[model samples]
Target: MRTYLEVSGGGVMRKQPYVCGLDAAVDVIDGKWKVLIIWALNHRRCRFGELRRLVPGVSEKVLAQQLRELEADGIVHRESYDVVPPKVEYSLTELGDELNTALGPLGAWGKRRMAVLEEAGQD
Candidate 1:
């Protein structure tokens, strides 16, 4: 186990422990919707409604919460515009783009595994 330091709201530092680099990476994207959100925003920025349509099956509330979490984690960037109807667009940060690139091999492996499972009549 290794420890990392994080600052609290009270301006105090605390130690957080993780087993390895993968553990720390997984901690940033530990939810069902986060990866999908990142994927959806990979190519372009999207408004709330656009994101909802792109990521089918996610409720508005959950999507909003997940976006907030991703923003706090520094993986997503939220830009607000001063317009008549109030415009907000979400996009991936540079860190998020790197994370997406890292996930490519995992996604390919999953595709291969799914084919194997389907051939075995298990999927």
Candidate 2:
């Protein structure tokens, strides 16, 4: 029986045997920019420059890289239009939507923690 699943990104593929479901899930969103990218695309499809604006701190290169990784992980869909300037847009896939839903509780917890910290003058 196979114990590990295959994952690919940025033209590289590998098999990872995760100890738990959280481990597998965290692996997909390991970077700082990925979750932000997912969040930015959760509502609607966005073009590259628009994504950069929505994400605030992400550079054009990093946004493109994160989008590629998300697409490779089956969490994002990229559509291209062969217009004069060649337009492209990114949106969350079904898997990505589910992933965002799964993150709701985490977001709530973070918000609560942030509030507590603010009350304690920690931030």
Candidate 3:
């Protein structure tokens, strides 16, 4: 078993035995419902309960977990207001917006692949 991972350009061997930046990036965004949550916040900011309703079938625990993770990863921003009924909202950060732009082509490719598969199945 290989103990070290190598980076291509720098001839650098990571002795820590961990994933590189790209792998970490993929890991952060990867989940059954993560993209959905990201996409929901793509257009506008939303509150916690609103996000829960926006993303169907996600339990409160799961949604909260995912949001926390996303926030930690710098993909989402959370703001709280001190009011009688406290208000909080979430929106995509600058990095999040860049990621959303990057994901668009990938989503389009997946859509095209699915359509092709469906057409093939109909034959």
Point to the candidate with the largest lDDT.
1
The prediction achieving the highest TM-score against the true structure is: 2
Return the lDDT, model 2, position 6: 63
RMSD in Å for model 2 = 2.6
Residues 24-101 of candidate 2: C-alpha lDDT, one tens digit per residue: 798888888988788888769999999889889988888887788888888999999989889998989999999988
Q: In candidate 1, which residue pairs clash?
A: none
lDDT of model 1, residue 74? 79
lDDT of 3: 0.80
lDDT of 1 by residue, 1-123 (tens): 567888644343435777777877887788798888898998699999999999999999999988887787778999999998999999999999999899889889999999999999999
TM-score of candidate 3 versus the correct structure, residues matched by position: 0.77
Alpha carbon lDDT of each predicted model: 0.86, 0.84, 0.80
What lDDT does candidate 1 reach at residue 42? 80
Alpha carbon lDDT of residue 15, candidate 2?
A: 45
Backbone atom clashes (below 3 Å) for every candidate: 0, 0, 0
Question: Which residue segments of model 1 deviate by more than 4 Å?
Answer: 1-15
RMSD of 1: 3.5
